[model samples]
Target: MSDQSVTDSRLDELAETFEFFDDWEDRYRYIIDLGKELTPLDDAEKVPEYKVEGCVSQVWLLVAEDAERPGALQFRGDSDAHIVKGLVAVLLTLFNGRTPQEILEFDARGALDRLDLAGHLSPSRSNGLFSMVRRIRALAAARGGQSEPTLH
Candidate 1:
């Protein structure tokens, strides 16, 4: 598979793994493993301006949409913590390039339920993840509605 295809496949696999794990420890290990699979962000994309604030670990995100593929955002991210980075990677694979309406409609909490991940996570980590998703959705809305102010 090409790099992007592999990433998409890996995310599908992760959803499967989350479904299979019986315990949080196993899930945690799997999340860390997912972290290991992430492609490191390019050095040029790691500028302080791209940093995602409010995350306990260092997190950076870059968003772009291919002109040929309208409404789909492409995301690249990195973090100092392996597991956190993995989580970001998962989010990128699932939501990148999607329309703002789709992003607004996406039930991240529901997806977590499908993954069986929420009950397994530390509350703080879960909160941070929510924050990340909100930020992405907000960005999508901003770009999608360039002429209007978006409501939170």
Candidate 2:
């Protein structure tokens, strides 16, 4: 299977899992648990250059080409706030290990909406989430890794 399908399936799984929760509190805890699974970034990698601007919480994202996957990119992110960190973790699970074109093709807002998450977020958190998405896309674009369009 293609890498994008794998990522998409994970998003589907998350959406399904979220459906089991009766309230936002349960979802929040589940998201927080996902964040807890992420390895904390080293203090040195938490520098200002990687810091995501326009977020209420401190967020930093690091993206690198996946050596094993050739053109794919892998992400590492961290946030100071628990819920925000969970959001970062969600983004990572959604976008990591995909090629630049794949990243560009992904509809993050739609995916979040499918998971029934977007409307529940405060304006600031929504802005911050999109900020991280832009950062990831910007990094992908900067790498000059754009792929040629394929004919269906």
Candidate 3:
């Protein structure tokens, strides 16, 4: 299967698995396994300039743009934490190479709920995930000319 197919399928599988598992332990293990399935990110992509701020773990995200196609962004990310790495993997697959409108239209919060991930994570980890999502959205908005007014 293509990366995109696996990405969408993984989301569906997560929803089904979460529904079947009654215990958080099982769910956590399942999530870890999911992380294991992530494709290896290139080492060169994980530079300091790509590092995502506010994550407790060492997380990095890199974005590339295609100017002719406004709002096109490609992402690559990595993390030291296995689970966090998996989470970033999932996000990269979904958001990468997407147009700004597409990224903005995605229901990331709803996807989290469907995957049943939010309730399992600690407050800080959840915050980190939100921060990552917001960063991607901001990048898309800035490139697409849909950015909201800023106080600066």
Per-model TM-score versus the true fold: 0.77, 0.91, 0.72
Weakest 10 consecutive residues, lDDT, candidate 1? 143-152
Runs of candidate 3 with Cα error greater than 4 angstroms are: 1-13, 65-72, 148-152
lDDT by residue for model 3 (47-125), tens: 7777778788878776678554455788766788987877786677567767776677777787787776677798888
The residue ranges of model 1 lying beyond 4 angstroms of the native Cα positions read 1-14, 146-152
Model 2: runs farther than 4 Å from truth? 145-152
lDDT by candidate, in order shown: 0.71, 0.86, 0.72
lDDT for model 3:
0.72
- Top-TM-score structure, candidate number: 2
In angstroms, give how far residue 70 of model 3 lies from its true place. 9.9
Deviation of model 2 at 2, angstroms: 2.9
Q: Return the TM-score for candidate 3, rounded to 2 decimals.
A: 0.72
Report the number of the highest-lDDT candidate: 2
Question: After best superposition, candidate 1 residue 81: deviation in angstroms?
Answer: 0.1
Clashing residue pairs found in predicted model 1: 72-97, 73-97
**Cα lDDT for residue 64, candidate 3:** 75
Ranking by TM-score, best first? 2, 1, 3
